[model samples]
Target: MKKLSMIAAMLSLLVSTGSQAMGPFEVYEQALRNDPVFLGALKERDAGQENRAIGRAGLLPRISYNYNQGRNDSKATYLNERGNLHEDRHYTSSGSTLMLQQPLIDYEAYANYRKGVAQALFADETFRGKSQELLVRVLTYYTQALFAQDQIEIAQASKKAYEEQFQQNEQLFRQGEGTRTDILEAESRFELATAEEIEARNEQDAALRELGALIGVPSVAVSELAPLAQAFQSFPLEPANFDTWHALALANNPILASQRQALEVARYEVERNRAGHLPKLNAYASVRKSESDSGNTYNQRYDTNTIGLEVNVPLFAGGGVSASVRQASANLEQAEYELDGKTRETLIELRRQFSACLSGVSKLRAYQKALNSAEALVVSTKQSILGGERVNLDALNAEQQLYSTRRDLAQARYDYLMAWTKLHYYAGTLRETDLARVDEAFVRR
Candidate 1:
C-alpha cells in the first residue's frame, strides 16, 4: 500500500512538472519539418516535378542559326573550243541562316506528356506515404521510452523492498531468532534486485536515446504518457468483415496507388513507341545571303529567303521500331503483374495487422485481470508472512509477477496503437490529423 501510494504521488508530480514533455504528435511535427529521411524524399519529389515540362517541351517551337565559311579553287583544260584553257578560282565564302520550326502533330510527345502527369502524381502520393510512416515510427519510439521509464521504477521499488527484507532477516539472525538460510536467501534476492535495477536503468537510457534520434534531437526529457488505464481502457474499432479491409487496401493504399500510376506510364510507353511508325512533319522558314567567285565566269552575290514544310515517312527500319514496341508491350505487361502482386500482398498485410488489433483487446483484458490477481497475491503473502504462515520468497515472487504483468500490459498497449496506425496506412488514410486522434488517447503531461 505504501509503495502504491508513493507511485501515485510520483505520477502526480511528473504530470504537474512535465508540461514541456514531447509527445508523439509533437515529435512527428518536428520530423515533418526537419527529419533528414523524410526531407530527402521531399527533395526527390521536387526533382521529379520536371517530368511534365520536359515531356511538353517536345511539342513546342524550336529556333536555331547555322553559319558556313570556305575558300574554293579550280583548274580546267580543254582542247576544242579555245586552245587548251586553264583556270583557277579561290574566294572566301560565308553564309548564315536563321531557321524556325514547329511540330504540328507529335503523338509520341503527347503520350509522354500524359505519362509525366501520372509520374508527378505518383511522387506526391509517395511523399504522403512516407510522412504517414514517420508518424507511426515516432509513436513507437515514444511508447518504448515510456515503457522503459516504468521498468526502472518497478526495478527500483523491488530493490528497495528486498533491501528492507534483507536488513530485517540479518537483525533477526543476529538475535538468534532467524535461521542462517533465511538471511542468506534474503541477501541473494537483494543482490538480484540490485542487478535488475542496473539493467532497467540502462534500458531506460537506451530508449531515451533512440527516441531522441527519431525526432532529430538529443535525448533530454519527454512528457510521461497519460495513465495507462486511461490510454488503453477502450479497444480500437474492428472491421466488421475481413473482406472490407482487403477491398480498402486495394483501393486506398498509397503504395498501391503509386504502382497504378506506374502501370499507366508503362501503357503510355507502348503508345510512344508505336508512334515511331507514323509520319513526322515540321514547318520551317529561313533566309540567307552569300557571295562566291566562279573561275569559269564572274563573281556573283545573292540574297534568298525560303519557307517550306519538311516531312519524314518511316518506310523501314532494321526492325528497331518493332523491337521497341515489343519492349514497351512487355514492360506494360510486367507492370500489370506487379500491381496484381502488390494488391494481394497489401491485402494480406491488412488482414494480419487487423487481426492482431482485434485479438489484442482480449489479450489486454486478460493481462489487466492478471495484474489485479498479482497485486492481491502480493498483499496476501505479506499478511501471511506477518502471521508466520509464509516465507519472504513468496511475497517477492508475487511482487515480481505484478511488475511483469505491468510491463506486459504496457507492451500490449503499444502493439494495439501500432496496429491502428498500420491499418490506416494500408487504407491510404493515415495523416497528420490522425496523430491528433492518437494524442487524444494520451493526456498531455
Candidate 2:
C-alpha cells in the first residue's frame, strides 16, 4: 500500500507538470525519447549501417597467422658387427604459417556486395517511413484527446441547461402554474443529460490515458484548440488540388520510396543467387617456418614462402544453385506485386484525405450556420412561450438542439484541421514546421 501511494504521487506530479498543455509537436518530442517503436527504428538503422562494411570484407585482403607445436617419442633397434644395439629418443617440433588471400575475380562475392548495398538503402528508407508514421500517430492521439475534451464540454453544458430548466419547472409547479407532467418531463431530460455528462467524462479519461501511454506521460491533458472563428482563418490547404497532392505522394512518400528500395533489394537477391553457378578467382600468398628433431634431418630449421593465383570452377551443386535462383526470382516477383499494391493504396488514401479536406471546409461553414440558427431558435422559442405560441417543452427542445449543433460545429473544426494535417502526411511533406503550424490552432485552457 505504501508503494502504491508513491507511484500515485509520481503520476500526480506528471499530470501537474503537464499542466502547461502539450501540443502535438511537444508530445512528439517526448515520444522520440521514450517510445520503444521509434527507438527500435533508430537501432535498426544503426545495424543496417554495418552491411556495407561486411560486404566489402569479401573483396578486401584477408590475413591470418597460425602456429603448431608437437612432441614425438621414438625407439629404434639396430644390429651391428658386435651385437644388437637399442636407442630411444624424444623430441619436440614447432611450425608457424602466415597467409594472405585477396579476391581477384569472384562474381558471387561481387553480387553479394551489391546486394548488401541495396539492403542498406532499404533499411534507411524504412527508417524514414517509420519516422513519418510516428508523426501521424502523435497527431492522431493528440486530436483524439482534444475531441474527447470537446465532448466533455458539450455534455457539461447540456447538463447545466437541463438542470436550470428542471429547476424552473419545479418552481412553476410550486406556484401552481405548471403541470406535474411538465415537471416529470424536465426531470427525465435532466437525468439523461447527467448520465451523458458522466459518459463523456469517462471517454475523456480514456482518451487522455491512451495519449499518455503513447508519450510516456500519465493522465495527460492536451492544449485546447483556439476558438474556431480565430483558428479557421489560418486553415487553408496549400497547393489546394488533388492532382498536386497525388504528384507529391508519388514523388516523396517515404513508404513508397522504401518499397522501391525493397524491390531493388529483391532484384539484387536474384543476381546474388544466380552468381553461385559462376567460377571464382583469388590470389594467395603464404610464408611458413618449421623446426623438427628426432629425424634424419634433426636439429635443422626450414623456411618456405609461396605466392599464386587460385581458381575454383563449380561442377555440380546438386541443383541447389538453380533452385536458389528460382526461389529468388519468385521473391522478386512478389516484391514487385507488393510495390504495385502499396502504390495503389497510397494513392487511394491520398484521394480520400484530399476529399475530406475539401468537404471539411464546406461542412464547417454549414455547421456554423446551423449553430447560429439553433441559438436563434432557442431565443425565439422562449419568447413564443410568453405569447402562447410555444410550450415549456418547446424551449427545452430548442436548447438541446442548440447544444447539439454547437457540438457538431466543434467536431467539424477538428475534422478540418486533421484533414489538412493528413493531407500533408500522405504527401510526405509533414515536418516539425507543419506540426508547429497545427500547434498555432491550440491555446492554453
State in Å the error of residue 308, model 2: 1.2
- In the predicted model 2, the residue pairs found to clash are none
Q: Which candidate is the best by lDDT?
A: 2
lDDT of 1 by residue, 348-397 (tens): 88888888778888988998899889889989999999999998778767
lDDT by residue (tens digit), candidate 2, 1-445 = 7466446544654664456555677677767765678889999988987787787788899999999988878776789898988888677888899999999998778877887787787788788888888887877777666666677777778778877888888898899988888788877877877777788777767767766665554656444322223346336777887888999999998888888888987888898888888888999999989888337645679899999999999989999999999999999999999999999998998898898888888887888889889999999999999898998999888988998887787777777777788788788888878887877777754
In Å, residue 241's CA in model 1 sits off its true spot by 4.7
TM-score versus the correct structure, for each prediction = 0.80, 0.86
Residue-level error in angstroms, candidate 1, position 132: 1.3
Task: Please give the TM-score that candidate 2 achieves against the real structure.
Answer: 0.86
